[model samples]
Target: MAEQWWRRPVLVDAALAVAVAAAVAIAIQVAGEPIERQADFLAYALGGLMGAVLLLRRRWPLAVLFATVAILLTYYSLDYPGLAPAVPLSAALFSAAVAGRFRWAILVAAAVVVGGLVARVIEFDMATLPVASAVITDAALLVSIVLLGETLRSRRERVEAEADRRVADERLRIAREMHDGLGQTIAAVNVQAGLADDVLDKNPVRAREALQVIRQSTKEALQELKTMLTVLREGSETRQPGIDQLDELLDVARKAGLRVTSMTSGEPRPMSAEVDRTVYRIVQEAVTNTIRHANATTVTVELCYAPDSLIIEVTDNGTNTQQGNTSGFGLTGMAERVSALDGRLAADFLPDGGFRVRAELRT
Candidate 1:
């Protein structure tokens, strides 16, 4: 898609150039002293040139500032007009400051003010031009213009930084969603595929059941993926799996060959969407890890609700070969999710012979 015509940089610069040129030319004609007929055209030419130099300000701000200052100084040196020093130089100073050249803009403004005041003292009598008053007024006006430009630059930078932060946050949310949603489904599918391969000829009925589980797991995974994509593409909220879906989640694990059971001991109450999603992800990750790494036949998921907190624990009676390697992405993501809600997570080996994951989330 094309950028709006007014928003295009080239078009904006062209408009600014025309405005500056007109302002400079009008300032000269309105305030300039009478000069020779031919010299008036030269004066106007110099003013237009000052404005024209601004067209390149974005690319070479310092150069443009210097060029505009040189043109203004030349116009005044020829005794063309007694225009205000801040008027013609304001645009250039602003451009330089906005381009992050604040020091250069300040130095140029100071030099112009000092040089112009000294020139006026030398050319006109001190009585004719109130030298001190003129110097004070001109210096204040130029400083204000530079300050304005610097303020705009700072504001623009802050806005850009906030935008970048939001983009990063959105990306991280999407990643966590993908990991939680698809990781469990893929692990179940892997287990079912292995079972089907092992019993393909020897136990045709078992193999068929395993294949059916694989088909269902894949279908669920595809549906979850499509839902996530829809949320990303349309910027709409989709129903995320929560504690209410635990039954279906456990059933899937059972179909994949793991005898999974869940028990809730707390008085179930409504939770915020974020907390609900986090709780589901915690259990989902725990189960997937049990299926993949903890070679266990039976798994138990427990949910205990207290007055101010919700506690979840998943334990499996399996030979967890990867017990020491609990720092995988799944656990790390789970820990982050728990930590985000000011909660705590513990993943350690049980005393007897299994692995356990426990999380406590504050309501």
Candidate 2:
């Protein structure tokens, strides 16, 4: 896998080197002064070296830039032929800039431009106007190449950052799911196990019922856990529990000895997948907390659907040991879910000795 990961870039660099070498040869042949066969061979060899050096650009961008500049300067110093600086130097300058060596690229580019201009003046004794024009054109092209490299570097960084953020978000989502799902299931199982143990010697029938609930809850929890793990490993989408599963959630709570009731008001509207899943998780986490901490016998789950938002309230008629504190992992996960949807969450002890968790989510 590691070898394969590096193969593509190596292949790309090889192709780029070939292209640059070809471009240099074409430029020299088409625009250069006529010379003997031996001199022509030497000129082409030097131009080829400029492109061949690009193979090291990714690992040694500054060195590649320097090598290209030296080769170009040497080519002109020999009075062999005149080739446009853009042909061979552009790739090296762009490579350096993209590798986060913009300063080095800029300095090398300036040196090449000045050196080429001086060589032209000394070799051909060009007029003042022509030299000025050449300088402007070369400077503009070189600057544009550097700017293009910088733009590409910026774009690549932005893309990588976005990808990292998405990975983090997904991990957080899975964590919340594991906490809410497993936590609730285990709480229910604990309640059932206790009931079974108490009734085993007194009422065999009731004890069997509690054990049945435990078996069913564990079965469902294991399946859901398997699905979540599969999604995490394969990066595939799976059907997540939504508000439609409220009945089952309430059933589990009931079997855990809590009188769970749900009430929905206003018109029921469809929600985005994320919103639906979040709503279910919020309710699940709230109920799980009640089961584990509230010591409550009755849980009232209320949903108020409005034109622009949905309000969820889970209230329990039991003592809330933590009172209004939202410090537990369960509450914190709920808050995170609500905040991600641009919503609000409030958890507080009701004045009447019960605890209430309310969340308002935008549709």
Best by lDDT: 2
As a whole number from 0 to 100, the lDDT of residue 153 in candidate 1 is 98
Worst 10 residues of 1 by lDDT: 30-39
After aligning candidate 2 to the native by TM-score, how far in Å is the CA of 274 from where it should be? 3.2
lDDT of 2 by residue, 1-363 (tens): 366633698887888888898888887887755562334788999988988999999999999998988898788778765666697789999999999898888888788778768866986699999998998899899988998998899999999999999989888877887898888889999999999999999999999999999999999899879978887777646677899999988888988999988999999999988899989999999998888788899999999999999999999988866745635578899899899899999988887789999999999
lDDT of 1 at 18: 88
Q: Candidate 2, which ten residues in sequence have the lowest lDDT sum?
A: 31-40
Clashes of 1: 0
Model 1 reaches what TM-score against the true structure? 0.92
TM-score of each: 0.92, 0.88
Please give the distance, in angstroms, between residue 172's alpha carbon in candidate 2 and its true position after superposition: 1.1
